[model samples]
Target: MADARSTAAYLCGKLYATLWALGVLGTAAPTPSPLTPGRDESTARFPRDELKRRLAAAGAHMITAKGRGGDRAQAASEVFRSIPDLIPVAGLPQKRYTNQEVLQFSQGCAAQLTTYREKYGSLLH
Candidate 1:
């Protein structure tokens, strides 16, 4: 099941790029959309130290949290790991990015993903 979700997320990322290329979805214009808080952030470049700080601020612990239906921590980790795949759209020349930029880019990607899900709900399922 985790494998399936991972594959789905990978496919979703690819589909987003395809849609953007086809102009179905907008380009990575770097504009502040409702999903992304643009102006509030300094730049779209989150460093490791900052990332650790942000995670710490969020009270993220190392313990794995599991539930009856599924392991959400694992799922979230999987998603977090997949974030690097979005660097192109985020306009990050390097792997490193700002937390706000990362968040904004993530929000934009998620928004595009939501649109994709709505458009191809049956196909994906």
Candidate 2:
């Protein structure tokens, strides 16, 4: 049946999304490997002001930049950037990574988030 097929597809997608969030599909090896094993790239090698300058070079501003308003993907990236490494999630520290690395991890988080929104949002809303 059409309804049955839709339901099954949805369930499979949901399960896949959850597994991906759990990092079953991530690049790094399974847990116990330090998520960020190195020193802070900016602080360790560059001065704080220079680090800010590099982030600005990367198009990040203390004030939100243009063309990003209402763009969920961009907004998700900003949220991800704001996360500190001190915060731990799923047995990983959120810090000590390069901006690029953090952003990559954020893409996975955002995908999982989007999937969750698709799955349970209508019910909760």
Candidate 3:
């Protein structure tokens, strides 16, 4: 039998492949909703607004926890990994996000927060 890490990796790979096969891992193309003519439901339901809120909250928490020297990127990554439901879009299982993807998304969120702070000052204050 494969070691625990190898088995986990193998399972994760299979899961990703299955998600792709089901067309759940590609670009979120717009699909018009009959009820909301002219509006793409997929885009409408994306969790961007929620994500921003969560990122800001996480940033605030990190700042409070470590003052100015806190690692916001690492904190954001951990928050996202621990709370997958914070992500707005859906279809794939929560475990679908690989560690790399979580890191990338967290880093992106952290960068966006940094830019916002540079322009508008601290979010918490």
What is the alpha-carbon lDDT of model 1 when measured against the actual structure?
0.35
Order of the predicted models by lDDT, top scorer first: 1, 2, 3
Please give me the total number of clashing residue pairs in predicted model 1.
Answer: 4
Give the TM-score (vs. native) of candidate 3: 0.26
TM-score of each: 0.29, 0.26, 0.26
- After superposition, candidate 3 runs with Cα above 4 Å error: 1-95
Candidate 2 segments whose C-alpha is farther than 4 A from its true place: 1-91, 123-125
Q: What is the C-alpha RMSD of each candidate to the true structure, in Å?
A: 13.3, 16.6, 16.5
Clashing pairs in 2: 85-94, 85-95
lDDT of 2 by residue, 1-125 (tens): 33422232222222223332222112123432112246333332222242333333433321232333333334334433443331223323224545543444434434545754564442112
Q: Write down the worst ten-residue block by lDDT for model 2.
A: 19-28
lDDT for model 3: 0.33
lDDT of 2 at 2: 38
**Per-residue lDDT of candidate 1, residues 1-125 (tens digit):** 33322333233333332233222112213323222365423223433343334334222221322221133344333333444464344332345444544444444546555664565443222
